[model samples]
Target chain A: MRNPRTGWLLLSPTLIILLIFGFAPFLYVLFVGFNQWNVFSADDGLVFNGLDNFRRLVFDDDFLHSVGLTARFAIFAIGSEIILGFVLAQMLTRNFPGKSLFRIIHTLPLMVAPIAVGAIWRLLVIPGFGPVPFFLDRWFDLKYQIGSYPDQALWTSVIMDVWHWTPFVTLTMLAGLSAIPKEPVEQAKVDGASRFQVFWYVTLPFLRPVLLTTVFIRIMDAIRTVDEVWMLAGGGPGTRFTGIYIWRVVFPRTDYGYGSSISLITLYLTIVLCWLLFIAISGRRKGEVE
Target chain B: MKKRFTFILVIAIALLANMSLVSADMHGWWAEAAAPYAGATIRGVSESTPPSNYVADVLAAQFTELTGINVEFETTSWDQMYSKAINDMEANTGIYDFVYIEQDIIYSYLAQDYLVNLTQFAADNPDLAYEGYDESAFTSFADYFKNADGDLFGVPMEAFVKVYLYRKDLFEDADIMAAFEEEYGYPLAPAENFDQYRDNAMFFTAYGENMDMDLWGTTVQGSTGHPASTYEFLESIGPSFGLYNWGINLDAGSAMSANGGALDGDTAVEALTFWLSMLPFAPPEATSSTWDEVASSFAAGRAAQGWVYGENAAWIATDESRSAVTGNVGVRLPVTAPGVIEAAEMGDGYIGYYDGGAFGVPHSSRNKEATLLWLQFIGQSSVQAEWAAAGARITHTATFDDPLIAEQDAKVDGYYTLLEEQGPLFAGAPPFPFHAQVREVIDPFIQRAILGELSPADALSQAAAAVDEELSRLGYGM
Candidate 1:
């Protein structure tokens, strides 16, 4: 904090790593978007094809469908996660018996890797071997088949996401809730302010920034989710999100130029979405202050 | 007496020296040829299938011990194996010395010149060639990996057909057979035609329901999300209905009947419809099942019959630890439409897919010579019998006669016998350099059809048109 030179030198390693691994690939991908490069057909090399890839993306129904599907998925998954997370966070803020144990148990799903979560859910839902189907059939007399039914597959993915990331949202919200000042709440209670009125006026405003940040992070993560969904469904009928679709194009099809163009478009869409979300939330907060 | 003893000792010494020379001729070639690359480590990547696992765990270790050249083989999921290998080769990274070239994808690899010409490599390095490893020893399956000029690109590691598997116990049951005969008005047996197959599926499904048994009539590899579903419909189901070469006429470069392709023909629609009809008789998991899961479903006794990849037949039939229906499993050729078998016999069409893969040295490989030796090591006749037993695959004709394979054949209900006798009826994927590109475009339509988002007839019509557009984009049939 004292000397600029020392600070610069200390930060150089991290900067170099970010430059080499992060920025370089991003730049390369951007460059690749303007060319016609089939990774398998290397003999042709990277031929500059101008806006052809972009033009192709416009007409590419699969890419468009994937983008729309990803948007819908992010909305459902992040919305559920945020609401559940906030409620859990509020409950955890209170003094309760075995609070530490409860917190640990509630947060366990957050520790599971995305790929492992997909594998676990896949095992749980697969008809014969999975217990979920067995229990559903036994208890409700309903035949639960995620593999055959697209609706079931899509909702199962949503549920899996909620199960996996709600804990992370809860943890973040819990931290924010703990940091909220207690003096105002106590004053409101002495003045005979109702619990709901006091909480809405005081706690909500305090947690606004934390809520926005959590929503932003979860939105980005949910949009880019591939591993869990792919493992569970292989981007099958209902769960072919943008991440899996892009992977299919780039890896299986090996159409680097088209894949790159689609990726760049997705990136722009994600940025715009986050920006709109930020503006709306921040504008609301500013209006309240006014 | 002393002179005679000395003469006899001298003769004995000469005979011992000659025997040592013969011994050196038989086995010393590997070490002597591999001397230059002793400390060099050659890396390979393959799908984590049984054959590839054997190569990774058993053959690699044995090869290292014999030649002193370290073998580092990485076996991963099917998708990762391909992406990793392709990325390395395309980037010219020299990361993998060899990669698995599946029979279906060899055309693409060859078209890109991504693989080293193994036949030429051996000719160029005569001393490095293993005497026992002759290309001629391989079965007809090896021909799939050859180029137009008759040069081999890959060494065949595994080869098998997709065969129809049935539950022998159910088929042989006195009550079940009587019930089946009464309903279908025919002797209850393995299906010999499409109608019989359908009837069997319906009967068994109802029979299970009536008897309060947990069973389905068939396993449908109809996953709406994965390529396995496309493979099932196109390779297994379509071909059984007499639609060959994915119903695409490569010569005309079209998938539409209007353009001379059979993709949207009545036969293809009939095939798709029949396959969809079986979905009700298949277990709930059938819609989500890949080839792996189909094998599992059969092994778990969830399906009475199914079209299963032969590579899984051995384990599902004999490995009691994994298979509940081990002893009750039976193998036979898939039921074909009328005239389909004749066409296959005449070598004009195929009944089903003959699926397999070979390990080939990449052009980008830094250790081609060393990798070549490793390939030859696995391709040797002496290794075929055990490899065949382990993987349920046979690349060499001689493997069928091997005592180990013969023993395995009986255990798997003479699967090897059927393979040897009927393999000619099955064919590898058509030699299309645009295989993946075409498959990608057509896959979604098949998926849509399976999920009932599109009718089978409509799906094929749209898919055929899409394939035409794609093929045209790729500059085919211009």
Candidate 2:
């Protein structure tokens, strides 16, 4: 291990960053959750309301609804990204004409900044005037206007996120695919394993670690995303999602104390959930060797 | 492990070093910013998220030229600015020398003494005093800027009113006019009534459908954030219930004006409901659109009508933009209720007014003298005239009154005429504490009604409950 002391020292920066950004802010938020002070108010003037804000968040119907909505959005968005990304990676792995160009074209989305992507999608999908409206009209011959339904805004947000982030999943999976040895697959085939069996058993097992890692990273990014939601719906046609809800409270209202509390709560939830997923996935594969 | 450790270490060191550079580059003076104010890197912030803030290069350069004070004007979207401002201010880090305090935010800032009171500063500086600034010139627009006790805490930063704009050639054309008048039982002479305005707007928009042109009758910014263009529909319906009216005195003395003239429950409710009913006619994605979105939509000729603001009048109406109908854009008066007073009974009135107050020195200013000098330079007729001609609309009559400014182009004249003619219907900022929170409820509810999520009555009722809650929280009248 090259001396535990030196090894620890070498890894100290990451540990320190994790402690400060990861843990400290999480702890501060719990402390802040009890107070009624906002950012505009004096920090000393923070009133210890003894979970009054949390009581509001936990008990309020809208707060609980958004929690449900967030869980639903995360599940759908992350799951879609993974499946679509894997499919895209699989397709690109095969030899084909214009394979390089296809790979580059798919990654173009990942290259664009999240905000720029959000802005472009907003322009394209605008209910009446945008290309999305045109595309819908041409495809279905029936108008799919964003005006009639409020909840459609939430769905549109999901589609935009899928478009901008699936490529990230593809890249991660492609890297995993490259790390697998061709000999293992050939041996499986020689043993009379079907092509589907070779992929389902041999190829898939090797890619398990990568899949788990990608899902973990993707879940974190998807939860924190707000740009597309902000640009597209403004948390409307009704305030339902956590990301937009946080932004709306902070800016025009300047409710820092409450806003910070919500942010901290989200961060804590994310960390705990991520930890649980890691342990669960790692537990399932404990007996297996690399 | 060594390679992994080194790789992580390199990224960490670079990130920390970069953060330090950003920190060093940032004006941390906001923490202890109470210096003599000169020879200091003063951090100033504003959330002018529109056609104006894009011209920050001009504002920063002019500010430096006028005061010899080099300002580090940090621009962020509204949320970040609010978050950073509040965080920095609470920390007492002299981070910001100047901050944009909307009229509504004054109450909280004043309650906590986060902002300095401006009464004493204006008194101390004779040249920058309110006397020379023409109080009568601002009378019709002054109520919204004052606190409950009549103290002016924050002056207007920037403001522009909404005007009903339509296609002139289309409105004058015989086919469209005949159908509108035929169906609505009224001649559409610039839409003196809401019935006429919507009916006329719809007529021109529907005519395009009939003409097989890719056009709609009218479009207004339907965004949840400030739906100023939607006010045309609101005011159109407002007059039906006495929800729209302001004092129009020939003399500026005793000169009274309503706070959007919304003082009572019925008027407030009526205004709220009447305002929302017009949203359905707007573009489908109006909920996300802000001022710029609305301007582009109108200019593209895809939309035949929009409630135009002076801020974009110069740009949207110009030929360089390839707007659907640039020169053909005709400015019309804001329409009122059906029977109160038609164009037949009374001529023109201020339909929807937004107060944009300029800078005044605060009692807590580190250098009140220097701040007032900056204020005077901004208020100076010559400078104001130049800014007006350049497209940053000031509230002062003199800026638009100047021949230099008014003659710059038809937009300048249009801006001048709108200010002069619409002075009667002016509504200053709603003098409320937590200006933002109050808006959070009102703006959303108004949009809900327009998008048909809530009926006009339901939206108003929900909004009333929300506003009442905010008012109670802010220690307003119980």
Candidate 3:
């Protein structure tokens, strides 16, 4: 659309900003990952320790446990979100009374900040004062205490994530659903095909790309979740996901070297995961073309 | 007789006039010293505790008004405050003129040379030294902020012990007393030993259950994932069982008894087990409670007894709007195991944590001269009484005798009296430069124990091993 030099000049500012804020820190963290640097002990500057931090990470039990916890969280949270989001999106595709109001109400949770969401859920589940516990105790004689029960605390965080993020999935899927052509469904109906058959053969194939994209995004986000969980349970008991584990190390412990090493490992693992999903999506598209 | 009365009156009048002149001279000194930096805006950061809030809202404004200097004090959560201050100092960003240094972390700061020696600073700049400011006016707690050479690095702002608080009304109730005595074969009183404390906890818990009340026996600061839980075990509960200095032998660089430390010794295991045993008697919220929540739980009348920080004692005993057991709150020293109190008296150990903080001028500060004035202003005897009343923390020895504190002493069931007389028994955290690092490694094990993921014996054993490994890695005792 323009001369090459003009385009390069116009993009220089954004490229420079990206280099300064994004690429520079990434390179610094990578460098730090190979060194022994405790902020309190950093007056002597970074001590080059080669792969020592990475070597230690291999045997770090707490970090390993946090990785497992994050994996579990991602699977449960993203799984429930996708299924629930698809169902909601399907329902919204149909004409209904107060549909606009329902959409607005449903999307409100997505608008709340992650930190606020965590605070809100914490208030909802706090013992004695929280209505969730009060009602559970009154109706079912159940003692719903997140502070004591690790399993309950973990599940509560999953539920909180679901509540906060399902709206995004629903809206994205709804857009995909709306953009689907009507002719195939009409032809399927004309052919005396059942609703399940039409959905499987016509509607689902068209929605596959959107579903893949949504799941990919959710997986990336859920794996890195810290704020809401930190706010809700404060990385307490069952809620010390990988992100919170890294935060505890870097900030509270001030173990910059180990924290950097763990962060890089997590980043690499995340990239590998997205690559696999990307391969799956690309492969599926090629198969469809055939 | 008239001549004698006239002579006495003349003497009194002259003394009063001299006092006013001295006060005026002090204010004049502040103005003259601050004249160089009159228009400069000095920034500081502290945790949003009552004392720090007083410094921000009241003292800052007063200092500014007196000297025409602008002060911007940011009071935030404890974690944020520490992270911000440490980051600024480490980076030499000069973002903060002064920072609150908790008694526990002052050693770390001193080791890093992150703070200005206020004593030396004042001595070098004699013109800026306030005549009214005296370091001796502070309680012995001020000694915690001194470096190896006995040079002052921080001005003590707040100091209080973790005291045992119980429900006076319930203890005094005839029926409750009879029931407790019938069950325990002793008169119900503030516990004097570990066994008595446990018996009281059990009896009170059962009594509350039987009476269909919302009371528990005690509050436990046992949040499984927070540092508060570690502090409860190490600083508060462990010392009561005669395990001191976090059971770590700093000289030997070990936490294992075999290596000359008592971290995993029998007493530490017993301490942890005894503390965990109270969980059944603690309210459902105990597992989630930190120091703040423990205070709130006691104030709400949900716990009949608890080891509460003294900073909360005044409010829990007097603030009816926030406290349900205001008039019935009682304060005492925590029950210690046999020989523990003796050890504390001999200075071989401590009974519990003496928690407080002080303001220090960071070495990275751009306005050290101006900040010194603010620190001294708060350190003065005239400001101590009101600040102590507002914050339930007394750093100045004279504050306990002030009329305001005397009135507060009655309302808080002589909490100030206990602090003044018994504060020496409750020591601050050990002077470990690796305090945060060691705590982080050991905290998970303690959390595991709290959640029943590990037995008390196993938790302490593993924690001891972890601490030893960490200390060795840090080249301690090498």
Q: What overall lDDT, based on C-alpha atoms, would model 2 receive against the true structure? A: 0.61
Which number leads on DockQ? 1
What docking tier does model 2 reach?
incorrect
Docking class of 1: medium
The models' CA-based lDDT, in order, is 0.90, 0.61, 0.90
* B196 Cα displacement, candidate 3 (Å): 1.0
Please compute the TM-score of chain B alone for each predicted structure, in the order given.
0.94, 0.71, 0.95
Question: Residue-wise lDDT of candidate 1 within A1-290, one digit each (tens)?
Answer: 68998999999999999999999999999999999877444244788989999999899888888887777788888999989999999999788999999889989998899999999999999877899999999999988888678778888999999999999999999999999899998998899989998878888889989998999899889888999999898898778999898899889888888889888988898899989989998898899899
Report clashes for each candidate as comma-separated counts.
1, 25, 0
| Predicted structure 3: lDDT | 0.90
Ordered by TM-score, highest first, the candidates read 3, 1, 2
The TM-score of predicted model 1 comes to: 0.95
Q: Between which residue pairs do clashes occur in model 1?
A: A236-B225
Best by TM-score: 3
Whose TM-score is higher: candidate 1's or candidate 3's?
3
Please give the TM-score that candidate 2 achieves against the real structure.
0.79
